[model samples]
Target: MSTSRFLPALRVMLALQTVALLLQAITAGLLLSTPGGRGLHNASAGVVLVTALLYLVVAILVWRPGGGSPRAVAPAVAMVVLVLAQAMLGALHMKALHVPLGVLMFGGSLVQLVQVLLARRAVAA
Candidate 1:
């Protein structure tokens, strides 16, 4: 497969992850504030869920044995694990861990973005 096709998909995944992370961060802040509400929690959870799915799709595409090498397999597995952990944290109302998880999620997305960009550049050259 051409790098251009997969790279853009990867970037879309990263962008989704980034937005999810930001939403989590903001939701964490709101959760810590006065008069707690379920709305914010639900919203954040939804965002995380959607972004996790997006990441999963990207991971699958990248690691697909038929289309590419097994390079992204590890990261894809890690991302799935992270998504589950993050969801668990949310369900358990572990607000303290939200920021940290958001940071980790963002870092993971950044790594994916960098990898995609690098691969695309190499293919272009």
Candidate 2:
């Protein structure tokens, strides 16, 4: 497939990742106040991980075919790593690190999503 085809896929994956991260944050709040919160948070963690991996895969596809910037790969990799670390921190009950890292992940994912959207507009223009 042409590299351009991967752009749409990449954008979709980034959007998914961003949404998943946001849901994770919401569930984290629920986790603090409700008995069902922990289960929802835990499930959302899996969604975040899956979306990150999908983003990484699309990033590689975009880069490997010489259609996209290699820079995209780095952030995708970082997202995967950050999500894994976040999962571990939560599992270990390290709220101090987990909370801050979750915020960072959500912020970063949002930024990445915006970048991808802007890039698409730039391409279309």
Candidate 3:
């Protein structure tokens, strides 16, 4: 199993996740700070959900044999779980929880992205 085989793809996905995080962050701010862009804000939140799912798929890809770190599964699962809760928070109009949770999600994704980018791939044994 070559750990480096899928590294590039994993990195790309993580980067995309970061971009999605940025978009989500901006939308969240707009949602809270202004009243004129609810549509775009909602759309961005949906995009964040979709991107999180995409990130999970890539995370699983990296965690599989012949690829990235097994520990990546943690963040992958966390993203799914967190996103689900985030959706629920939004639906319930729990802005207090929803906003903070979104921040947490963004931070988690950022941390995972950094870890992926900085990792030294294991040499195939």
Candidate 4:
């Protein structure tokens, strides 16, 4: 695909990642108060992982040494790492770390999404 298509693709992936993370957070809350919460949370974790991987792939495609910024790659990598760790922590029943990491992931994803959207807008203008 052309370079022009990469940005929009990246943006779509980021948006999906952001939404997946948000759903993870919601299901986490459900996990506490509802009987079926655990299953929902577990399923959402898989969705989050998939979205993170997709985001990483798109981020790499969007990165061009001379034309596109490499900065996006770092956070995309971080998201994958964090999501893996988050899954491990959750599976290990390490709430102390898992909870905080989930929150951090959500916040970071939100920031990344905003940055991508702004970058696209800047390019358009």
Against the reference, the lDDT scores of all candidates come to 0.70, 0.89, 0.75, 0.88
User: Candidate 2: minimum summed lDDT over ten consecutive residues — where?
Assistant: 1-10
Candidate 4: clashing pairs of residues: none
| TM-score of each model, in listed order | 0.75, 0.93, 0.82, 0.91
* Candidate 4, residue 44: lDDT: 96
Q: In model 1, what lDDT does residue 45 have?
A: 71
Clashing pairs in 2: none
Ranked candidates, highest lDDT first = 2, 4, 3, 1
Segments of candidate 3 deviating more than 4 angstroms: 33-36, 65-67, 120-125
Question: Across residues 1-81, which tens digit of lDDT does each residue of candidate 3 receive?
Answer: 236566677677778877887887787678778886677777877777777787777667767754656776677778878
Rank the candidate models, highest TM-score first: 2, 4, 3, 1
Tens digit of lDDT per residue, candidate 1, span 1-125?
Answer: 35424656766777777777777677667776845645785687777777777766776676563376566556766777787788888788786895588688778877776777787778778
Candidate number achieving the greatest lDDT relative to the actual structure: 2
Q: After superposition, which runs of candidate 1 have C-alpha atoms over 4 Å from their true positions?
A: 1-4, 34-38, 95-98
> Which 10-residue span in candidate 1 carries the lowest summed lDDT?
1-10
> Positional deviation of 44 in candidate 4, in angstroms?
0.4
* Model 3, TM vs. native: 0.82
Model 3 lDDT vs. the true structure? 0.75
lDDT for model 1: 0.70
Candidate with maximal TM-score: 2
lDDT: the better of candidates 3 and 4: 4
